[model samples]
Structure formats: C-alpha cells, structure tokens
Target chain A: MSLHTEYSGPHAQARSGPQVAAPPPRNSRHAAPGAARRFLSWLDLKAAPYLLVSPYFLLFAIFGLFPLGFTLWYSLFDYELTGEQEWVGLGNYSELLADDQFWKVVVNTLAMFVIATVPQLLLALMLANALNKRFRGQLFVRMGVLLPLVTSVVAVAVVFTHLYGRDWGMVNWLLGLFGIDPIDWKAERLPAWLAVSTMVDWRWTGYNAIIFLAGMQTIPRDLYEAAEIDGASKRRQFWQITIPMLRPTIIFVVLNSTIGGLTLFAEPMMFYGGRIQGGSDNQFQTVAMFIVEKAFSNFQYGYASAAAWLLFLMILIGSAINFMLIRRIGGRK
Target chain B: MTTLTVRRDTPGARRKRTHRGGAGSRIWDATPLTKVMLAFTIIVSAFPIYWMIVIASRTNSDAVDIPPPLLPGGNLGENIVRVLNDPDAQFLTGLTNSAIVAVSVTVSVVIISTMAGFAFSRLRFRGSRVLLLAVLLTMMVPIQQMGVVPLYRLMVELEWTGQLKAVILPYLLNAFGVFLMTQYTEQAVPGELVEAARVDGASTLRIWWNIVLPAVRPGMAVLGINTFMITWNDFMWPLIVLAGNPTVQVAIRNLNAQHSTDYVMIFTGTTLSVLPLIVVFLVFGRQIIGGLMEGAVKA
Candidate 1:
C-alpha cells in the first residue's frame, strides 16, 4: 500500500516543521540531538518492517527457491555423483515412465495412500464428532488421542515393526487366536501395505481429529438446534449438517493427507528395517524411497531429481482428485 | 457466544431442558457408548508408546516372547545403561544433537515468524499482501523433497554435509510458522493498539517489542512447541545428510539396522529418543492442545 512512505513522509515533515518553528530559545541547544532522534525514528519507521521480514525471504530464496530451480536444472542433465555429466533432456522422465519398478512404486505409494487415508480420515471425522460433545475431561481426552503425534515417526515405526514381526509378534499372535495363519508383514505386498498403513494412521488420525474438532466447534449451534426441532435425529443431522458444514475442513485435511500420504518414507523405510528398497521384493517401496535410493545409494542425482519432480506432480494430482471428491461429498443435497 | 453460555449452564438445568422435548439436543451430551469408544481410541493412541516402553524394559528373549511382553520388566535400568554405553548407537550424542538442533531451530523460527507476522499484520508496507501470499504458496511446495538433490550438493560443496548446520539452515525459515503467526497476530494484537502506540511516538521496533510480542506470546509458545517437536522428529533430511553424526531419528534407524534382531536394545534406544518429548507433552499438553486447535481454526 505504500502506507509507510505516505504516512511517515509528509507526517514526519509536518511534525518536524512545527517542532522547529516552536522551539524555545533554551531548547535550541538540544536541536542537533532532537533532529538526530527524529531521523533515527524515521529510519525505524521506513525500514524496520522490511528488516523484520527479510530473514524468512532471504533464507527462502537461498535454501528454498535456489534448490527448486536447481532441481529443474539437474533433472535435465544426466548427472551422477561420480559419473560424467551429460544432457539427458527428459530421457530420465521417459525411463521412469517405462520402468516396471517405478510403476510398482507408484502403485505401492497410491495403494498405501488409500489404505492409510480412507480409514484415517473417516476415523478422524468420527473422533471429532465424539469429542465435539460437551463432556467432562475434554482436554484430557484430546491430549490422550494426540499422544501418538508426539512420538518420533521412527520410534513409531520401530515399535510397530516389532509388533508386526512374522514370528512371535503381538499382531500375528492375536491373529492366531482368530484361527488365521501368521502373516508375513514384510514379505507380501498386501500385508506390507497394511502394516505401513497402520503406522501412518496411528500417528496422524488423532492430529486430524483435533483439526476436525476445531472445525466442528465453529459450526453454529443454532443449525443443530433447528435441525433437531425439525425432528431430525442426531445421526441424520450429523450426515446432513455436520458433514456438509465441515466441507472446507474436509478439503483441508484431505489435501494435507494426500501430500503426506504420497510422501510416505520414514514409516515404510523403517518398516523394512531402514532399507531404502522398502523390502526384498520392493512390495511397499514408495516414490520417496525410490528418489532417495536413486540419488544416494546409486548416486543417480539427475534421475532422482526427475523422480522428485514427478512426486511433486503426483501430490498435485492427488490433491486435485481428493479436492474434487471432497467437494462432491454432501454437495448434491 | 451462545454456545459458551449453553455449555456453562448447570448439568441439572441442561438435563431438565433436554428432558422437556429436547431429546434430539441430547446429541451434545455424549452417550456411554461414545465414552467407551473414546476410551478405546485413547488406548489405541497410547498403546504403541506403552508397548515401546514395555519392550525396552524387558529382556531380549522376553521382548519377542510368544505373547509379547505386555508389562514392564525389571531390565529397564539395565537396558538404558546398555544403550547409553553402546558405541555404535551413540544414543547420548543423538539426544544431545537433537536437543541442540530442535532448540536452535525452534527459537530461530519463532523469532523470525513473529517478526514477519508482526510486520505483515501491523506494519503497512508496499507489497506486504503479495509477500504474504508468496509465503502461503511456498507452504504448498514440499521443499525438503523437491530440493534434496540441490540442497545436498550445496551442502557438500560448502563442506557442511556432516555438520548440523546443513540440517538447521534449510528449516530455519518455515512458511507454516510465518503463516500461523501472521494469522495469530492479526487476531491477537488489535490494530487500534498499534495505532495508539504509534501516536505515542513509539518506534516501530519498540511497538513490536512492547506491544506485539507480549500480546502474541501464546502464539509464539504454540509455534515454538510445534517447531521443536517437528525438528526433533525430522528424519529424512538428517538421514540423508547427517549420516555418521545423526539426530535421534537417524540414530534409531542405525540402531535398528545394527541390531535388527536385538529387540530389547533397539526398543531401549527408541524409548530413550522419545522420552524427552513425552515429558514435554505431559507438561505442556494443555497449551499444545489449545494452541493447535486455535491455530487450526485461525489458519
């Protein structure tokens, strides 16, 4: 708005003019210091705002903008850590498109995204509904649900990895009680996906629930009261009113989960005991792991850069799809 | 506001009101089933952490025992000692490094965000609106994933690959922190207060120091806590860059890799890594929860 220059420019001049004109004979001795003070204050008014905000911008330009641009540049070249640098010009992208392992990873990533997100969001919505009720120890309940979020992701992965251990693990042990054979969580595709999905959901569901609860709190109480007066049951009102009113929050949560879910790295990586391959068969390898594996393990810097860009595109597509889907939820009366 | 009054009403009065043709309004009062379901959710939320502790406290064979030890064992102290003394794990260094990095990043991010937030909210300047929008756009780009290759190259060129600075510098500027604080400052510090301070001849920095920061202290606390937690738990970047000298997360990965079958030792290290955060969560649980929900709505 340039409000700073407009206000400070003429205003400072006007104030200083009056001060100079009205200065007493005795005060004339202090005129120099007064003018210096005015100049310093003027500088503070004119420049402090920029100074205050520069750190984030400066740091972002260096660390954020540069790398983003550099990644694009790196993706265009056939650059490796130790090998000769050559121009690939989207060759990496084409190779990635045809690579069977790459497509498998993409499927694995999306499958895990759905496997993790569908139940996680639904559970969060229900949990939010439950927490929205007026209850004793509400704060206690919120803290308890959000406790998982406090633990490190690796720690969560490590614990779950042990629990899902094929032999003598708690999960398989529980399954044995159900007359089902012990599942190899790491060996098979479906079981591995399920294992990683549980880890994701366990860590994030409560956090999302809290966000949903916040959104629920903002919906007017009168809406519910009016629905109730119209003889609508609680369940009916929830379906008709709560779900529709929570559309924005649903979109927010859905987009966040999409980006987060597609970037599934630490959990699956730790699930396979820190192997970037995800498993021996690559059953649960994510695009993120693939990027890391290509760049660091194989030193294919340029190829990894292309894969990273594709991952970004995947997130964009994922978010757009989820956004449209969420928009459809309760949008049609 | 009406809801606040309704919530404050005596339970007996509320029950009486609900009884008199307000059966549907009883929705707000959780049924016993909801309570049971909520209890189960809490258990599900907390059990992994509890299980981690149990395994940490048990012997190696007891950890992978048939039923899997559900209760804490007497080996906790011994295991902790072993983990601390283990050369390969470097449990103590990881903790210290994580603490240093988390604190450094948290303090820097909070201060930077507050400064930027105050400016964006209070100080009217050229392009402020556009700059704020740019910050929002940056939040959508996952720079950590997108920038890994170049950032790694930069770190290697600068000889910062193994140092904590490489991990610290990139995360110092958090777009989310700036955005959160901007929203919070707008709501918390009134425009009239800034005008009044300006009329009183307070310098812009003074107004920020005397008025904005004090008003936004809660926002700062929220941001600080969240940043601390995220930084403490950050894995991918640290795993990539700080390979030999690692944070708690990468260290846990290393421990898992080294002792893939030594369940108790690995569990012990995991428990130790998460213990500090658990203590922080327990102490500041209320503020963290309140701040998070508040930030969620405002954001």
Candidate 2:
C-alpha cells in the first residue's frame, strides 16, 4: 500500500502542467549548460507531479466533498418543497427523537441486520469451504453461484415474491407436498421479514462465498498438509485453520453486509407492495423507504431531509461499529 | 463429524476397518473421496440457479404443483409473450432503460476515471498530494450513508426527478474505478515515456491521446464491464430516481403489487431482465473476478 501510494506521488509529479520537456541537454559538453539542464528537468519533474494529480482532487471536491458538505448544511435547515423554507435549528432532529415511526424503522432495520446478516455470512463461509475443495466442472459451479449476485435484485425479488405466495407459489406447493399448509408470507410482519431476508440471502450469499473462496485459495496447501500430518480431522482443520485464516474475510463480508443490511429497501418494499405505505401495514418499512416516501410522496422536504439525516447517522454509527468489530476480529487473527 | 473424516481420512474402511493412515496403499488415497465431496459441493452450489431456470420455464399451473416441477416445461415462450404484452408490464421499456443507464454509466466511468487516473499518475502539479488524498478518503465513506440526503436534494433541485441521467450522472466518479486506473496507469506507463513524448514537442493533450491511452487499455476493458454490471444491477439509487420512469426492476416492484395471480407474468419478466446480465457475466465474469483478485492481492 505504501509503495503504491509513493509511486502515485511520483506519477503526479511527472504530469503537472504541460511544460514541454526542455530540449534534451544540448551542448552537454559544457559543464555549466549541463548543470542548468539538470536543474530545469528537476523543476519540470516537480511541477509534473502536481499536474498529474490535480484532476482527481478537482473532481472529488466537486462530486464528493461538495455534496456531502451541502448535506450537512441542509440537515440544519427546515426547507420545504416548492420554495417553502425556514431555519429549524435542530428542530427536525428534535422531532425525530420523539417520533415513534422513526424508532420503529430503526428497530426494523436492526432486526433485519441481525436476522439476515449473521446466517448469510455463515452460509457464505460454508459454501466457500466447499468450493475450496477440488472438483470436476469447478469453473461451471463457481460461475453458476454468481448468477444470483450478478442478476438484478429486482428480478430476484420478483422470483421470490412468486415463491413466497400463499397459494399458487412453488414454496407453498413444496410445503403442501409434506402436508403443510401454504403460508401468507408477505401479509404478516415476521413472514415479511423472513421473505425479505430470504431474498437478500439468495442474492448475496454467493457473492460473499466468492470473496471468502478467494481468500481461502490464498492460504497455502501446506497449512492443510501440516494439519493432516498431525492427525487432525477435516472438521478439526476447518475449525482450527480455515476459520482463523478466514477471520479477515469474515470481517470483510460482515462489514459489507452491515452496510447493505441497514439500508434495506427495494426487497422489502417490493415484497410488501410498494405503495405510499409499505410492508403489511408498514411492518417491513425501512428507514430508507421512509425517507423516500417522505421526500417524494408527501413532499415534506424538510421532514424527509431530517429522516434522511437520522438514517444517515444511524448508518454512520452502525458502520463505525462494523469497522470496530472487523478490526477487533482481524486483530485476533 | 462424518463429513470431517471425508476430508481427512481415506475413502475405504467401509467394508472392513482399515483404521489408520498407513494401513492403506498411498496411491489409493483420497481421490475418490475428494471427487465425491467435490461433486456434492458443486451440485449444492449450482442447484438454486438450476431451480430458478426450471421454475421459470414451467407454466403457472405446473409451477405450483404439489411436488413442484423439477423439469423444465414448454411455457417459457408463452410466459415471455404474456410478460411483454401485458398492459401493466413495461418490461421491454424497463429493459431498454436498464441498457441505456448501464451503457452511459460505463462509458462515462471509463472515460472520466481513465483521464483522472492518467492525470494523477502521470503529471506534476500543485496540491497533487492533497488532491490524491481527497480522492482516496472518499473510498472510506460508504456512498449511501452520508450523501443520500444531499444527493437526493440536488437531484430534486436539478428537476431530474424522473430522469435516467439523475441516477446515471451523480455516481459517475466511482471510487474503485478512479483508484484502479491510477494504480494500473502507474505500472503500465513509465515516466520516461511521457517525458520522451513531451521532449519531442508533442502537446500534453496529444500525448494523452496517442501515448498514455494505448498504455492502459486492458485495464479499461476490465473496469468497463464491471461498471456496466454494477450500474445495471444497482437497486437503490435507481429505485429512487426511476420512481416515475420505472426501470425493469421498478416494473417488477409493480408486479408484486398485483399479487400472486400474476405469477407467470412476473417470472417471465424476471427471466427476461436477468438473462442479459447473466450473459454479460458469462462473457466478462472471469475478467471481473481477475480484476478483483488483482486488487485484493495488492491490498
């Protein structure tokens, strides 16, 4: 990382503003002229680095920093749709603090983060360990797992919505084969969460598996070799070696999943019927859904901005906790 | 626990207990067991997608049969036609919208990131370190967390509520693409090459067009497909931006609104929308995986 970072420093130095390189040290036989040429090249090189690196900064400032800085400014003001506005001075945040819907959305978002993320990570780990073994048609299998991840989430949500139906649905049909009754999956709270989480699980588990598999492949064959020589069982090897070695990968998936899970939107929104009110009576409505609904449906730009910030703060803290947790796990390994 | 023995111990000892390691011949070893376990692994991994395709192919009636149809059926074409022709189904339009968004985003990402990368990796200018650091720092910020409110406001103010460009334009400078190009540019392009071009009195713009671009095209190919797949599959920003416009995914969202009565219609739409992405992956998946691996190994 340091080497790449340092290398870019030199890269920037070389491309600064367009000074044509001084004509190759002509009459270099003259010591004084040669010295002056060397000085000129050094100055040109110094200026070159700046010109090269300028675009990234300029663009980042415009696209990245400016929008973010403006978000902070907007959060403090009570601005409405169609030019209605006033300075709120933390009034929005105060209202959100007392808002029960906000808390419900927060809790619902957390419930999803726990309900979906942990099991998803575990499944991905198991799948990775399975793929780490040699197999015929390994390429086909690996590519096949990626199908769900590569496909649009909307399509997956649509497929699962079919599967989750109480009647005329494949999942219910399968359950009926075992003499089980069909389930009204999206019409209730818990079932809705399960339905939404299942969609997430199907789409993401393979992606995390591939990430884990990539990490596992980098573990030398000798580690497994050494464990076998010690008479350790394969399960023992997995627990002792694979799990510890995969700790960082686990952390990576967890962090990615945390960010993804908290912002749960389209899947649940789609599952619950994406009207102004989502879920089975807003049971599955997430903070993101709330923000979008508030912003567009009601045109409460001030209120929506507040909700967006509240969610943003929740995500920021959630992301911070995720980072802290990952670093701690990584430290253990 | 038994699965553990499969990975560690040999395949035999079923008929008679050859308990220990050296009790068996060395060559007879773990081959059969490895092959069996490997087959199980692959089957389990590939089964769900196979199930989806099979389910997608079945008629609405056969699809919900008590046993659930494991075999592919002949109704896929019928379902596809129904999906396209349905009054409420904007699937074809959505597909077109997806293509437009994905292509535009990919082209812009590749062009901008490449140019910025070349500039960062090849030039000398003032505040280069600070600017480069700023770009790198944004990588740490999840684009969704802090930027959503402001970005939404900006789009709304720009009167881009139902525009594809609303989604396509804002997230153009992908943190990963910019970072990737910068790294690739550093290696593939040497400093002396640019200097040589400069000393020859070639303009900086001319050097960029002729010399630097050729040096870093392979990187662009990897980044291009990645950007396309990413923007194409993205759910959130598009879901927000395309609220009224309705992308393929949004159409799917609307399908869910009609209840399970339209199961066949919905699956048909799902199949059509996901098929192109699967094709894209089949074509470029290896390169995408390779690029990710390259970055991982570097990190």
Candidate 3:
C-alpha cells in the first residue's frame, strides 16, 4: 500500500520504482544499494522544499493566522481579560457602532489619516522628482533625508512634543517671531492633529521619497527624452509621462500609507505624554489608540476586537478609494 | 508607446543621448533650484534629530529657555548618567532588551526568509504558487493590529506576558521579509545555475548553502538591516505586551510620563536609544540605500 501510494504521488515519474523495471542482470547484486540511493534522493527531492518553507508556515500559523482567526471568534463573545467569556453574537460590534466615543475615534483616525497622508505623499512625490535629477553628492543627500527614519518613533514624538510645547517650544517661539500667540498643541483638536501629522510626516516622507525615487529610476529614459523633444515642459512631462508610468509604484505606496496612516498610535499616544486617552477630551485619539485603551485600559477585549475589525475594514475601504483616485492620475490626455 | 517603440527601433539611441550630454541630459541634470530644495529637505529631515541632541546636552533650564538653545551643551554627560541611573525608567535594561530582540528577530527573519525564498524560487514543488500567493496576502493585512486581542490572551494564558518572549515571538517571522527574499532570490539566483548545481549531484541543502546563500547575500543584508530597524523601533506590540519590562520605546514613554519636567534627562534617554542605530546607519548607509531601492523596484 505504501509503494502504491508512492507510485501515485505527484513526483511519481522522478521517483518511479526501481523494482518495476527489470534490473539489469549484470548489476542484480546491487539492486538493494540502488533502491536505497533512489529512496534517499527521492526524499531529498520531495522533502527539502517543504522543509525549507516549513519554518515560515509553522511560525506564521502559530503567531499570525491563528490569532487572526481567534480575533474574529473573540469578537463574537463578550470577552474580558479577567477570564470571563460569554457568547454574544455581534453584541460588541453593535455597541461599538453606536458608541459616541468610538465614532469620535474613527473620525480622529480618518481625519489624521487624510491630514497626514495627503501632504506626506505629495511632498514625497515632489522630493522624489527633485532627487531624480542628477546631483554630485547624491548618496549623501539621500542618507541625510532618511536620517529621521533611523530615530525611533517614540524618540521623534518626544522631540516634537517638546517642540510643540505650549509655552516655550521652538515652534511656538518661531511663531512668536511673527507676533503670533502660543498655540496649545495638545489641548486643541486641529492643532493636535497637525502636531501628530507632522511627527508622522517628519519620519516617513523621506522613506517614501526614496521608494518613489527607486520607481522613478526604473522608468525608461527615452520616454522623458521624447517628451522633452516634443517641447513639453518639465512640469507637463511629470504629469503626463511620469505619473502614468509610475502607476504600480503609486498603488503600492498609497496602499502602504493608507494602512500606516489609519494605524496611527505611538505618535499621538506619546504626543499626549504616553497616555492612551490621546487627550483629556479624546481629541486626537486614533482608532488604534482607542482599541488599546479598550483592551488594555478598560479590559473590553471583545469590543476592542470588533474595533480592530473595523480598523481593518477602514484600511480596505481607504485603500480602495485611494487606489481608484490614484488610477485616474494622468489617465486622460 | 510611440517612444517605447522608437527606443526598440534604435536600441542604442538612449545610451547615445546620455553620452551626448547636451539638451537630452538637461532633463536629468540638477538645477541650482533643485540643489537648494534638496538641501532644505536634508536639513528638515535632520533637524529634529539634531534638536534632540542639542536639548539632550543642555541643562533643564536651557531646555525650556526662551528661544531654546540650538547648540550642544556640556551637560550631556551628566544628563546621560542621570538617565542611566533613573530607577523608574530602567533605561539601560530597555536598551539591552531592545538590542537582544532586534538582533534575534533580524537573524531569524533573514534566515527564514532566505530559506523560503530559495524554495519558492528555485525549487519546483506542488502548491508553490498557492503558498507564495498566500504569503503575498499575508503581507496585505496588518496582522499585529488584527491579532492583538487573541494574541494577548494567548500570551496571558501561557503566562508569557511582560517577558521578552512575548515581545519577540510574534515578530520572528515576517511575511514582508519572506516576500522580499523570494523576489530577491528569483532575481539574484538564476535557474540555470541551480540546475547545473543539481546536475553535479549537489543536494538541495548543499545547493542552498553553496550557491543560493552566496548569491543572495545582498538580499539577506537588505532584509536584515530593514528587519533590525523595524524591530528596534517597534512600539505598540512591545508597549502592550511588555509594559512592565519595557523596550527602549516604552522606556522613553516611561521617562516622558514620569519626568515630564526633566527635559534634559528625557532627551538624553531618547538620544541614547537612537545612538546605536545612527551608528549602524552611518556604516551601512550606502548598502541600505541601494538595497532599499533595489528591493522597491523588484517587489
């Protein structure tokens, strides 16, 4: 039965039985050795690939996929971290939808996403375009721009939080040069969003630009040369040729920014001094922060799971919407 | 399309255009304006980090002084000592734990990624296509956020909370790393080379070690650096799981919360946390840049 199954296996041709073919009479004494060799080789061929790939699948199954499925299961029950679980089908989701604070967090998350991503991407695009031009110290400039990325997000938030200090921040000090009053960066909603967005953009803009620069490098030079020959201005060429050719890269970047922006947590959390409240009024509390607050702070494990699902859905909807919008860029003549 | 066809018609024309370096090169040439813009960009990119250092080195009074000091001060050593000795922050422990987690995660992710990459790219096996697609799908979902609840509960059940194991286990296998390595291996290792190695009766593992690993070292380096940077800077998960025992990011949070008024000490801790990565960046900046661009295009 084992032999039959082996014969019918996927690599049967390669692993065909040595016994099926009449062994040459001259080498009949070596049949056992030959079969052993074939078996070893068969095992090598059949097992090595799975062995090579098994670590990833095994680890991901335990850490990634299992938790993903369990999150959905957890969301269906009224679960708490204090070891209580009651089945309440969609109860958490329904309560979350009507929860005023939850909606505010969703709004804050989306507001910050748009506030951060739109200008961040636009600035990165322009930075990439500028960097695409041949320069003498190209590598130096690139490294300098990417320097912020090396700093931890918490570190960036710490520095920016101080810089946005209501009384004596350098930013407010700079504003005071123009006689403008001090702005309470954490107290107000819009200012808080701007402050957090700045932190996000400060860290990521250069990284995105480098990716965009990479994409720009892959576009054939002839297309630009042709557009130049046709008397199209540089600005027009960028809009017409560069944007169209960079569609795949744009899609990749936009989707990445969508997921990242919606998941804004550490910057705002640290901005408000490491409290998950985001502010006393919950002014800058992102959905991610809200989820953490619910699960860890309030011990609403099931409700936070539902919020996690909603954040996932928000990412999907945001990516799809942005993908559609990006596809239209340079689509028309 | 017309230009593409024209380039195909005269394949060397683009190369010739670049050599001519007249009007055609103008498009690629950096203008004075471009140089100025890039300079401003570099400064803006670097200033916050510079500001961190300036404040870290200054006195507490200098930290909030009107028109905040923009230059380094002599108090840096004193403040760093204060941070290291701070009982509440546990800054040194945070730094050491972060280093351990980052190195372990980077090494594991790179090795696992390279193996899976070689298998998916060089080996012909059933379910390869479907499995690779699954890895790609895995990359799309933010598993950390989605799985936080159950993962936390699992950790709690296992009694691993506040341990480095809780912080490090989830990150040991990264889908992005696998996807990157697979793309890289496909590009870097030729099919003919693998076939030739096989013809020499090289076992799959031998071929991987001798042929695939050597060829894909650059890809591994890229993945390793990126993974290290990410693991070092990872905030939310570590903050959630290891809140008591804390990584560097969480330690900074502790310092910020506990000593909100101790600007110099806080900045000192922040600077110390970032200093090692800056050193790594300085050493491997070129490879990091090249590998990132290369990975971007391939992926």
Q: Which stretches of candidate 3 lie over 4 Å from their true place?
A: A1-32, A80-82, B1-23
lDDT of 2 by residue, B29-110 (tens): 4456656654564565455556667766777677667666777878787778877776675777788888898898888888
For all predictions, the C-alpha RMSD in Å is 5.8, 8.5, 6.4
Candidate 1 global TM-score: 0.91
Question: In model 2, which runs have C-alpha deviations exceeding 4 angstroms?
Answer: A1-22, A25-62, A79-83, A179-181, B1-67, B86-88, B119-126, B144-149, B186-218, B255-260
CA shift of A44, model 2, Å: 7.8
- Specify the CAPRI tier of model 2: acceptable
Model 3, A44-107: lDDT tens per residue?
9899999999999999899988988988888898965667889999999999999999999999
Candidate 3 lDDT tens digits, B1-299: 13222222232443464466665577688899999999999989889999999999989999989978888998888889999999999999999999999999999999999999999988999999999889988887999988998999899999999999898889986999998888778766767667544544568999899878988899999999999999999999998899679899999999999998999989999999999999999999999998888777766
> What's the true lDDT of residue B69 in model 2?
71
> DockQ of each candidate's interface versus the true one?
0.47, 0.27, 0.47
Give lDDT tens digits, candidate 1, residues A61-156. Answer: 999899999999989889755668999899999988999999999999999999999999999999999998867998899999999999999999
* Each prediction's TM-score versus the true structure: 0.91, 0.80, 0.92
